[model samples]
Target: MMSNSKEIYESITTKTIVAEINLSCNDEQIDSISLTSEDLQNTIRIEAESSNSTNESYCSNIIEESEYKPDVPTEFVPVVNSVFKSLNLAVKMYNDYAEMSDYKVKKFFELHNHPLESIEERPYTKKARKMSYFEKEFVVHASKAKMGPTMAHKIRAVLKGGYEYVRVKVTDYKNLRRGVNIILCYKDAQIMINKMNDRRDHYPNYSFEFLRDGDMLAVMFWADEREKAFYAEFREVISFDVTFRTNKYKMVFVLFTTVDHHKKSVTVGAGLLSRETTESYEWLINAFLSAHKGKAPKVILTDQDPTIKQAVESVLPNSRHRLCMWHIMRKLQANVTDDLLKNKDFKKRFNKLVWNMHIKPDEFEKKWELIINEFNLEDKRWFNDMFELHDKWIHAYFSDTRMSALMKTTSRSESMNSFFNTYSQFGNLLLHFMMNYDTSIQKQRNTQKELDHLTKKAIYKFISPRPIEKTCCKSLYKYIVL
Candidate 1:
């Protein structure tokens, strides 16, 4: 009878405490504290029974399954038998026992203090944004196709019906591309090397060389069988120049180009260098020479880069190194006075003297001295420097060099670089750059084949009925037929 009375008293106390806690907590906090009152009551009853037993250790099996029926919702009521009938009553009794036993019960409400974001704004959250496998693959293929992130995103939106249907944002596409590049940064060099190796294995004439600084690739050069054949035939005069901003690593793109029989710019070979130092240029030149069985061109045209000049001199000691006339002439305004450049008489005489190919070197020198004296430009630093290097730039000095007149400037290389830039981008990975380069080469080759076909089928209407004209027409391309 006494035990029943005590149990009744405990159940009332638990219900009062539970009500107080419920009143103090907010709805969110109450939700976060997932522990039900029934569970707390079960624990309290177990502890009480264990304390009364001699064993002292709590055993959960003391509560029989028959004592608590399933599907019976707990409520606030008097304790019947020994089973817990009320969650509120159980919680209050557990708390009182905890207080007496000096147990500090901590209610950890794991709820966020800040208000939650709405469902509409949740997708824009950083944690919620992600790119799936298909999306990443799309980005990779799109990048390879020379489409940027913004264009790729727009195309995806169109394919998906609308921008609203797209799961990821434009920024996500860009971020994925950037992440892919970062991941491939270490493997790209090796991948390129392997690709080149495979090509060389398949085509015996394809050649490539690479230099590394520690484990990082520093320089690379490559030439295919067709390019090698082109070099062998049209290797008399080749223009070499470097283009910048062509890859993610900012590597200098070195191009060796020459005019083919069709008067088209053909790529002889190409290279990439981490830096444009004299040593790097020398290595690249040596690699090119090695690829072509050490046969240097008769005349090589390039810009006014002293490092390239030094490399050419050291590597191709026998080959004539000529400066690009266009590169030098383009700097006239910056190096000379506006008044001097604008003078019609000066421009007329200067253009004639600089461009004349029939004049001898001695006559060219005399004429140059006369122009300087007439213009009163004796103290001009640019003129003095150019005069010192006159042999490299003056057509009269290297006039005898075979096909030198055909490529007097590096314009072919510059044009070829522009063509490549159309297929490539400034933010390209090494693999993508090479892929685009191959595509460009294939397009040029196809164009060359088309031109060859047209030339073969062309029938000329001769203005003069001369055997020499007919012979020339038969031997030369349509553009070169005179």
Candidate 2:
């Protein structure tokens, strides 16, 4: 039998919907939305045959397997155990579905809207009544008699120790509503509340905040949002090449910046903080991986500080860590004779030749060797000083793509150091801010950090003084964000 083209086309025109739904069986739920052409092929054939009363070939399944995904376009994931509240589930079923699969049974009462007919292998079991008090509330694990603790409970207890306290019940008796409130005296309540803050005596209550912390803490708070989704939107990379002053050589801070950002120290407490070790580099990495995951950077420009190198290796080993040529050039500039510094012509030519090292390593070396020969550099000890680890400092790997677009410089880190300079200049610790005595203060609190940066930049420029050039460094620039 044959059918007209228009009739055949009409049969295949309706939209095909693929959705993922939860399938609960005997206290278990599995989400899978993989409907292959074969699975729907029979249905398609039956509908077509009923409509056409004629055989026809349809080619809608011609798309590649690469395009197959049964989830809603923006649904992100097919299913989450978070969707159902009554299904406390082996609560442990979360740890490993396999364990839940092995241990699940049709215990006593069928808990949810869908019921399990038999005590078969599955994840969660129905809850039974014999309420008990949790630390924060009065509650009970469903089927406490047979089910025991859920997987979530087992994992939670193993990770976080259990503590108990009295709670005041806030109840609306008429509405069958009650809430448990922790009972704490002023002292205990204040102490816990203080700890909740970053232990800062003062903080500007914010309209918005970007909190960077460990995965464990992140997951606990934003469990529904992203467990390990701390990613950085970086435009540049700057390095703070300094060791901590902590008694134990702890990682106090990792000074960093982006071209489109500001220079700031990543200080997430030292020794046994939210993490285990105090190794400055290790903790530095903890901050980076915590902040920037998956979006591997192109390069990281740093100084030749061993501690910093260790931190970079642990956190972003793949990122190219190049020595800030500006810093290196300045270091040598100080050793350079006044005759060299004063002679603008010589300095200009010398500076031009040195910068070439970043772009064309071979050409820079060839030109440098020629310049040395042209100017008796061996006699002056200039050639001897530039050769050690020269490529490691100036090559493409360490070259910041973001910063290079600006004139190459470590001005960002220098700017941050300038900010730290005000405290550094005082050298003496202040017992308090004395906010009540603003008349005694020379500058506004808002201006203090900026003043420090300006002063430091002035001092660095006085010392390094090639010129004031913008850097492509991302984070450092963010500090002065408009």
Candidate 3:
């Protein structure tokens, strides 16, 4: 019975040592314990004392004292001494932990030394001014209206004297702006959902489709009543282009556009896609075509992205596809030397070869071969590919077709891109982008209406009085003397 009790006493003592080490060593000291188990054991032996004795405290007194002095001599077995020198390291680690905890405790009390100001009252000691509930409501409404914090804060200061509200600094508003944006994210999404649900009344025949990948919205295509009407009126030629990172969602903004009679760009359809894959392009194109009653345009102009090209071909098999001449010409400058572009003779020759209206297909081939060999660009892949795909954009091929809108390039689409860039900022909320787009489209249609009125009612000055010219002039509403 005595031996069993001794064993139990030893077990209890071991547990007491473990508890003491745990109470003494802090989170920072845990890494030290992991590295050196022998040091940990030594620490436990030195720190843990008999719990059944008259002294009942377990590490409370030692923690308060902070200073730890070793009881034994340092000189011992050299090999064992070398290994257990980590016990001193463990002591240093505990010291740092204790110092940090004490500093934190001091700072915690120091921060609370001054009492918090009441929400209804301003600071009493200083000439402290606080924004009133009315001012806060105005700032929040301004933020929801998409006014920047600096401007909102300035407006708040301007209204302080007239009302009883106190003026707050821009610095105070800066902190509130971040929380406001987080709230606006979900608020704006819910607002868009409401609009999308009730769009049938305001935008008849409007269509919208969305795909979601788990919780995140993946792709969406939308066409309003105006877009559908524009497509039906002028669907002969269309330019398809996609702009990236135009909204807060980092979505790819796709637009289908065409030129009005006055040569101004008009949007036919618009979409936002989450990815640049072939599947997304296909879905967007399908949605766009379905919205327009699947009436394919005679000619579709675009860049040389293979996925978009393939999607267009698959969706609209009957439409003739054409690459943008300006995009192809950009590659011409990029692939060639700067000196060649600057050289007067080379520049003149290159422009004539690219833009000459009188050059036949055989003549074009002859001139192209000569230019390639003269410029030592025969081995260039870009030059060779343009040569192979000459039928798509080399004006001579499609100039005879009356249905072709003669829009061999996507320059108008590029113009639309720049126009939208001015109104729609990067990382803008999706709903804000759509709202700005409404204003932009309205401006375009208004300009077109003015131009149409001018074309119908205005007269033109004639250069000559020849009978053929007079007869030609009599057949038309009005003509501009070029």
TM-score of each: 0.67, 0.36, 0.62
TM-score of 3: 0.62
lDDT of each: 0.77, 0.38, 0.66
Candidate of highest lDDT: 1
RMSD of 3: 18.6
Error of 1 at 200 (Å): 1.8
lDDT of 3: 0.66
Name the weakest run of 10 consecutive residues (lDDT summed) in model 2: 218-227
Model 3, position 46, has a per-residue lDDT of 40
Candidate 2 lDDT tens digits, 199-291? 233433211112235322210110001112112444344444442321121323234444432333321111112222326346444544443
Per-residue lDDT of model 3, residues 1-482, tens digit only: 44433433453333322211223333342112222334434433443343324333533343344443333333321122122123345344444443443311111112112222233344321334455667667765664444666878767756765223534667667667566567778876556656775785576787877777786777777888877877776788899998865688788888898865566688998888888888889888888888888898888889999999999889889988889888888777787788887888887888788777667888888988998999898888888988999988887766665434457788778778877776676767777677666667777778877887777677867788778776786565443210
User: Largest TM-score belongs to which candidate?
Assistant: 1
What's model 3's lDDT at 87?
37
TM-score of 1: 0.67
